[model samples]
Every structure is written in C-alpha cells, then in structure tokens.
Target: MTVNNIAATFLLGGIALSTQAQADFLRDGKATLGLKNFYFNNDSREGAAKPSKTEEWAQGFMLDYKSGYTDGVFGFGVDALGLLGVTLDGGKGRSVGSTMIPVGSDDRPVSQWGRLGLTGKVKVSRTELRYGTLLPRLPVLVANDGRLLPQTFEGGQVVSRELANVTFNGGRIEHATGRGSTDRTGLAAVGGQRESNQFNFAGADWRVSRDLLAQYYYGHLEDYYSQQFFGLVHTLEFSNDQSLKTDLRYFRTESSGKNSSGAAGYRISGYTKEGDGEIDNRTWSAAFIYSIGSHGVTAGYQSVSDGSNFTQLNQGGLEGKGAGGASLYLYTDRLTQSFTRAGERTAFGQYAYDFTALGVPGLKASMMYLRGDNIKTVSGDRLKEWERDFSLDYVVQSGALKGVGLGWRNGKSHSQAARNQDQNRVFLSYSIALF
Candidate 1:
C-alpha cells in the first residue's frame, strides 16, 4: 500500500476500534524525547578539492511515540517519529562536506529543518506487519545513523517468529530520507545516478543452539544488482569471566538488467572487470573476539573479489547532498573509510576496555586500526591504505543526569585511492520519558 493508505489505516483503526481496545492501546503506549548536541570536524590532509575542511556544530531533537497493539485476535497500532535539527555553527566554506546539516540555495547551511514520520502496524499470532517509515538493520540494507538524525525508508516490512527457533524477515523498500534531509528520494547504489524505486529483500535467522546463530538473506534492486548473504555467529564461554566470539560473513553480488548491460546511469562506479562498471563481486570477512574481565580484543580479515567493488544500497550520487550517507553491514565500514575496493585485502584489530571494573561504571574506551592493500586500480596498479580510530564514551549512571551520555571520536586515514583526512566528533545526548 501507499504512504497515504498506511496513514489512513492508522487513523481509521484508531476510530473504528472498540473503546476497550483503545484503552489497551493507550495504556501500553510510550513516548520519549531525545536530545543530542554534536560537533564534527574533518580536515583533508591531501588529495581533495578546495574547501579542505568540514566543520559544523548542531543540536538535534527526536520525539518517538509507539502505541501498543489493540486487544483482539488481530491487533492494530501506530508509531510516530519527529526529528528536528538546528545548526549552531558553520556555513558555506566550512560546511562543504558536513552531511549532518542541510544546504540552502546560496550554498549555505540551513538554520533549521524538521520532518515527521508515521508507521502503521498490525499483529497476528507471532507475526507483525509494518508499513511507512522504517529503519531496517538487515544484511542488505542498514539504515545510516552516523549523523545527527538517522536515515529512514518508505516501505513495508513483515517479521515473523511463528517458528520455534527461527525468525523470518522480508520487505520491499521504495524510497529513503537521508539522515540530514527533509525530503524523500528514490534508492540507488553508491555511485549510480539512476533511481531504482523497487528493492525487495528477504532473510531468515536460525538459532541453532544457545550460543550459535545462522543467517541467510537475498536482496534485489531492480535494474541494478542482486545479492546473497550468508553469516554465522557463535560464542563460547570460558572460566574466569572469559569468552570467545566468532563472526563470519559472506556476500555474492552481480549485475542485473540495465547494470548488466552497462547502461550509463545504472552502472556502478569504481574499479570493475575490464572497466565495464558491472556489478560482480564476492566479499567475505571473519572476526574473532576474546574477552576477559573488562577488556576485549578483536581481530579480523576481509577480502574483496577482483572483479568489482562490493555493492550495496547507497544514494550518494542522487540529487541532494544529504543523500550521501550510507551504512554497510561490514566490519570495515569504519569512521572514515570502508575497505571495499576491488581486489582489496584488509587486516583489522581493535582493543576495548570498560571502566566498570576500575570504579568508573559509565566509562568506556576503544582503539581500532585497519590496513588495506592490493586495491585494484584502473591503471593496473595496486594501492594501499590505512586508518586509525579512537573513541571514548561515558554515561551518567546515577543522580539528576542519569542516562546522559558523552562521547568523543577521532580518526585518521591515509589512502592511495582517495584523500587523506583527520576527523573528530564530540557529542552529548540524553533522552527523557514522556507519557
């Protein structure tokens, strides 16, 4: 159904339900107001166009309301999200590449912008159907939330848990509103200019045991590409607060329709087999994490096939600047770069510590590094790159400021395929319950 139809369903359901049902819906409903103050700065060290730096500060507000399903064999409910962003600083030159703020006609940052979203939902037995605004976190499509506001999609999704040890998910996504945008746009690949209004996906997760899970998913973007994903995760517990976790992921992707025919607007960008711009790639990664006490160490290796760069849904090449942010379900999707170039091989490691054992119950810190080499270049050369990232976060555990969170992140990247840059972000956030 269309967005309008979904909205109408919410309205009509509210009015048509019996008084007892309405009472149940409202009784179990909840609302929250979230606040975030963010500051971002990115300095291009080399190999970038003019306006070598992007700096901005902003305040964000989000209101979330969720209603419980009515009391009946078939239940109905609704959810609403309200997002607002106000620029505290930065304009024109300094805001060039800041994706958290919107730009205006004169190439300046907009003072403020806001949007509202609604979702209609229905439930029966152990299955649920939701339509309208969505934030999907599946293997093929991950809604971006790296900025002040999160990316949202216009679509319909169904999740079922009728099976004892398995869960099923499927969806059809038609459009997206970027994390920094107030308008919705069609979906496309990272460098694709043409819009593909239909994206179909289905997936299933099976819990094999108490500590092991298996997943399989398929996604198809009309006229663009199709992909299949397989994943496995397991955790092993040891003595003395020690544990080991293993995660394995694999993806196979290939061109379809226009993309397969090498059409201009539908073809992907970046290195491809014979420079044909076709989508053909196999990517995989495996990570192992060992935790002891309050410390965790992780190591992983990833590989991208030589035929083409890994592909997923991205709207960066679309018309709006805010349309550029996207998130990938890869360990390599870091703060500054995604090691996804064709023929790339990357090794990454991370060290994280929680301060709870050290008397600071709300503090945590992490450091990560990734090095990628053997990146295929169109000129038949191999390129290499590396990145280092650091993060520190704290949340108040008690008192008046309980649940208030503060965070700082820093990343430096040196790359042969793109610009070298240093980036920093600081944010403070809190959420208030509302009846």
Candidate 2:
C-alpha cells in the first residue's frame, strides 16, 4: 500500500474503535512540543578548489503524541510525530550542499519544509508489535539525529521482554528519510548506487548481573551484505566515589547476493579487491573509563581489517534524492572522519567534567582526541589522520526557564589522504509538555 493509504487506515481504525476504547485512549494520551534554534558552520582548509566555509542557521519544531492502549487482553495504541524546519539565515553560497537543510533546484536552501509520521501498535503482556514509523536504537541499527531533524524509518518491529532481565528485538526496515530532507529513499551501502528495499535485523540483550550486560545482534541488507555483532559491558565500584567501566565490541561481516559477485553494478564505493567487490571484514574495539566524582576519563582502541572499509547503511550517494549524510556505530566515528578505512588502527582518549561537583549544576564540558594510522588507500598508499574536539553545555537549573539548554561544539581534523577542516556548532533548545 501507499504511504498515504497506510496513514489513513491507521487514523480511521483508531476513530472507529468502541466508545470505551476511546475513553481509555484519551485518558492515557500524552503530548510534547520541542523548540530548537541551531547554527552550524564548517571551514575547509583545502585550497580554493572547494568552498572556504559553510554556514547556516535554522529553527526546528517537533510535536509528539502517544495514546494509551485500549482496554482488552490485547490492547492497541497510536503514536504520531510532526516535524518542521524554518531557514533563518542561509545564502546560496553557504548552502551549496544539503548539510543541515534541503537544497532547492536553484542550489539554495529552501525557506521551510516539514513531514509527519505515524505508528500503530498492539501490545500483549510484555511484548509489543508496531508498524509504520520508527526511530530505532538497536545494536545493529541506530537512527541519526545530528542535524535539524532526526532520520526516521518505515518498518515493522516486534519487541518482547517476557523473560526477566532479557529483551528481544526483530524488525524489517524498508525505507529511510534523511535528517535534512523530506524524501524517503531505499537503503544502500556508502558510495553505492543501487538501492535495496529489505533490511532485516534481530537482536537480544541480557543483563547477566547488576553491573554486567551482554548483547548479540545480526543484520542483513538484501543484495549487499550480512553482519553479526557481539558486545559486553561491565562496571566496578571503588572507594571514595570512584568507579571503572569497560566496554568491548566486535563485528563480522560478509557479502551476500548480488554484492558477492558484483553483478548488476552492485559494488561498494571504497577500496575492494581487483576481481569483484565483496564484503569481507572484521572490526573490534575496547574501551575503559574511570570516573571520580563528576570527572570522567576514557581510553579506547579500535581496528579494522585490511580487506575493506567497515560497511553500514549509507545513503550519501543518493544526494540527488535529497539524502547526503550518514553515520557509523563506532566510537571512532567522529565529527570529521570515521577512521574506518582498510587496515586502519585508531587510539582515542577523552576527558569530561560536570560542574555539579564544583557547586554549579547543569553545566558540563568535554574534550577528545583521536589518532589513526596504517590506513590502506585505494592508491596503495599508507595514510594517517588525527582529530581534536571540544564541547560545552549548560541547562537552566530552576525557575520558569528550567530545562532550557545551550550548547557549543568545536572540532579540528588533519589528514594525510583527505582535506583538513575545522567545524563549529551552537544550538539552543527547549521542550514543553502538553496534555
């Protein structure tokens, strides 16, 4: 069915329920509205060939509504989301690409744009089945929310937690809408042209102990590749309000279907073997963090095999379809570079502090640095890169403006194989609850 038809059916079904169902829905319904004022700027240190910088300012509004399940052994619920973005300041030269706003035919940012999403759900005991819109955060698939609006998916999902300390998830995603655009596009790997309509995933999380957790997940993109992930997390407490945390993650992936032999022009964009484009890779990382009071220190290392760059659902090649940006599920995925090139190894460290420990609440600051080397480029050259980032955030602690937030971020990246760049962002946000 068409998207419009599906939306209409969900709405009509809710309205046609019994009077008792309607009363319960209204009684348990909840709504919220959020406001965000954002400014983004990026400076490319490359030669005059590229634009010197990109700067834009915009405002966004988000309205969310969730209704309670109707009365019965098997209950039903409905959820809706409304998103709107207004261009406050952006010129043709500054908005050449669709970085934070959709670009029009004239190669300029549009004045405004918006979209609506709806989800229908049914629940029994501790399990729920949902259809339509989704913002999923599983081990294998995470929704992107770095721009003015969040990326959403069209899919059906089932989540169950019938067993104590264990949760299971399964889903099939068909399409995705970019964070900066209003159009929905099929899924593909980064730099790939062919679009695939099927992205199936399943996963489970088990809390082995109060301070330890384990996870396993699998994902398959038809005509592309399949992947498996395993993760473990543990925390230990010490005296004097000090604690240590450890995180380990691993992923194994291989080509499937058309990508196995590179038929129908189904080839990944990055470095691959000479014969045919195939996915063969193993990536892993381990991180350790120590905290004392409100201060945290973290250290981590990550490695990617020599076969291919780590693969993930990316739509960057679909720029003509209004989808340009993508994100990876790795700590090395930073503001500038992902550090996932073939045969790459990365070491990173971070320091963070919360002002609450110093008698000032609602204020936080952090700094991070990463260095990567031994990258295998398509030209058969070894490359290296490094990045440094800093951020500060503050939120209103009390009074009428409580919960209002202000944030600032700065980053610098230098690479031997790519252009060097500096980026900055400033944003203000506020949220209000509505019945």
Q: Pick the candidate with the highest lDDT.
A: 1
Clash pairs for candidate 2:
none
TM-score of candidate 1 relative to the true fold = 0.98
Question: Taking the tens digit of each residue's C-alpha lDDT, what string does model 1 give over 1-435?
Answer: 678578668857776889999987899899999999999999998864977888989999999999988999988899999999999998788885337888887879899988888899889999999998899999999999998888999999999999999999998999998887887889898789999899999999999999999999999999999999999999999976999999999999999989999898888888898788899999999999999999999999999999999999999888654688899999999989999999999999999999999999999999999999999967654899999999999999999999999999999999989889899999999999999
lDDT of 2 by residue, 1-435 (tens): 864457557667767789998788778999999999999998888867556788999999999999888878777888899999999998888874548888898988999988999888888999998888889988678888877888888888999999999999998999988888898899988777888999999999999999999999999999989999999999998967799999999999899988987875567877765535677789999999999999999999999997888998887776487777777778888877888888889999999999997888999999999999988777764789999999999999999989999999899999976679999999999999999
> How high is the CA lDDT of each candidate model?
0.92, 0.87
Q: Which stretches of candidate 2 lie over 4 Å from their true place?
A: 47-49
Q: Which candidate ranks first by TM-score, i.e. highest?
A: 1
Off by over 4 Å in 1: none
